[model samples]
Target: MATPVLDKVEAESAASPYITVTMRIRRFNPEVSDAVVWEDFQIEIDPKERVLDALHKIKWDVDGTLTFRRSCAHGICGSDAMRINGKNRLACKTLIKDINPEKPITVEAIKGLTVLKDLVVDMEPFFQAYRDVMPFLVTKGNEPTRERLQTAEDRERFDDTTKCILCAACTSSCPVFWNDGQYFGPAAIVNAHRFIFDSRDEAGEQRLEILNDKDGVWRCRTTFNCTDACPRGIEVTKAIQEVKRALITRRF
Candidate 1:
């Protein structure tokens, strides 16, 4: 006969269950071959665990060679951005339970960037375009010892674009960026927008001039891909539109 303590232990164990998750990642290694390959990993994990955790288990326990980037796993660093289930997202921000575990979760490097290894990509070109836009405050004259004061309305003007963490999630998701590597991507334009509306920044016109080039805001077709792919909830398409309007109306 089963004792009462043994029956209670069995009941408690039955209350907790873990789901089997399958991750199919697209891998590339220049040292090995030009051809890409799909690798599958199966692990038992809690439904609420993040995709980054799954990748860690595979790298730590299954294969030490598997590669990816991650920092500040809570998702502020944006280091773990990748294509998950046909969409660009931060792996650290994506929860396994949010996406169905019944289907295999597909992970790949963000598009439009050259894959350097299994999940790492060549961010040089991405950063190169970023540098072209001058993503910084440009104020002339002597620096003020006191804080530059602005009205609350002025601060709110460009606050939406300020949430970007330079993750490249929006840029890589853009169809325009995928086709032309030279185009200044949405991330660049969004950064420009952040400073363009500032009441104190004196270089708004200069940044607008740089973006007025043929490869600038006009290239954006308003596909809404960048807006959807941004992990920080920034209104990317609206900011790009505002930049376009600023050119015509010359108003912030």
Candidate 2:
């Protein structure tokens, strides 16, 4: 009986595929040092596992000092947004095999913000930009007794932008954001577009006014980095262009 159980466990272990890879993460702690350090971790992982899973193994099996943020682990929470292979991505959404595993996988905190610790940056600036755009629905008159009706076309108008989960992946990837901290990056513009195009929202012009500033949509250079980095596949650059055209034409 013991031999049979041992054989079964060995068979399962052999059936599972795994590879050894190096995970290089950037470490920054103000309390520790003013300079940044890169920490390397080697772990065995399945090809199907996500980058977030690798982080978990390193934190659990190797180093207890590693720190990061994650929730829901399915890319919806956006808490695990980081720079993977020198690009902004949600750890849960990026598979380890998709990136070149032959080389050390470089995982670092997103740029253009103060790093509170390893892998987590100050999200206050990101959220403040979001709040500035007034992401919620703004309407006039009394509340309707029933749910507000919307045509299929109206819903489709802003549907792409609505997929945003406030992940900050799109914003952190923009080069303009890396240079100018004042620019309300792609994430903010994408959220503004959500309400700006909604047929029922009456505050479109007001939001547009808020965006028509020196640090607004004009700052975007159409680098296409934001579009490439968006985990939700939101046409961020296109949305920014629409906002720019709206500012020019004064049309919602």
Number of the top candidate by lDDT? 2
lDDT tens readout by residue for model 1, 1-252 = 999999999997787667899999998888889999999999988888899999998999998988899989888998999999999999999999998989999999999998999889989888887788788778889988999889999999999988999999999999988997777999999999999998889888988998998989999989999999999999999999999999989854
**Model 1 ranges with Cα > 4 A deviation:** 1-14
Report residue 27 deviation for candidate 2 (angstroms).
1.0
On the 0 to 100 scale, the lDDT of residue 136 in model 2 is 89
Model 2 residue 230 lDDT score: 92
Which ranges of candidate 2 are over 4 A from the true structure? Answer: 1-16
Q: Clash pairs of candidate 2?
A: none
Each model's Cα RMSD: 3.9, 4.0
